[model samples]
Target: MRTRGTGDACATYNQFSLGADYAVSKRTDFYLVAAYQHASGDQRDTNADGTNGGLGEATASIGSYGNQSNTNSQVIVALGIRHRF
Candidate 1:
């Protein structure tokens, strides 16, 4: 899909994600999750004053959140544990 942000440029991306969960007990669980994204099209360049500077290639920022990557593709992986009372 196409998306717009702070400027006139538009960007397109394809993302894939996977997640798994394992229950160790009635009160505990283990989980793992991962995501990959590739961005294309053009993006706006912003100046220090928040003005549109120019247009450039779009970079990947997984889940549309977190820090923007320097390249066109990005990967994210996370593992954790959860417990209940």
Candidate 2:
């Protein structure tokens, strides 16, 4: 996290994340991840987690899918397959 100004000013707040993964087979897997973030002052017109800073509040973020939460918290899920060639 970074400060909102050049001085020691806290523009961001508390945050947390949780994730889990499971393997259905030797080459198959699934994953689930979720996170939460809070803001107080200003997030440069955005949330601390890449979400829209609606009314300058808290928000959340998704995975690398370029998606984010519409509210202060969000969840992300992924299912994939892997092979050892």
Candidate 3:
């Protein structure tokens, strides 16, 4: 699942993921995965602006923060596994 939001001058995006594994044999296994996402409004760096002057800078973009721009996306994949245990 995914979500998105927007505010006066802010926008946000988020994502969540879940995975599960299954055993097909004593030395073989398979896996499955699922994902969800949510988005929040844009974040203003109250500190970065030299206004708040807090420890870390405020969030100018929504979603999570930094590299992950307010507008972000997520994906998940599953694969097979082999073990001797």
Best by TM-score: 1
Candidate 1, 30: how far from true, in Å?
Answer: 0.7
Candidate 3 C-alpha lDDT tens digits along 1-50: 33444444344445566778888887878787765444454444455457
| Model 2 backbone overlap count | 0
Highest lDDT: give the candidate number. 1
The C-alpha lDDT values of all candidates are 0.85, 0.52, 0.48
RMSD (Cα, Å) for all candidates, in order, is: 2.9, 6.3, 7.0
* Winner on TM-score (1 vs 2): 1
Task: Please estimate how well model 3 matches the true structure, expressed as its whole-model Cα lDDT.
Answer: 0.48
The number of residue pairs in model 1 that clash at the backbone is 0
Model 1 C-alpha lDDT per residue in residues 1-85, reported as the tens digit of each score: 3345554677777888899999999999999999888888888877999998889899998874687899999999989999998
Error of 1 at 48 (Å): 3.0
**Models sorted by lDDT, best on top:** 1, 2, 3
Better of 2 and 3 by TM-score: 2
What would you estimate as the lDDT of candidate 1?
0.85
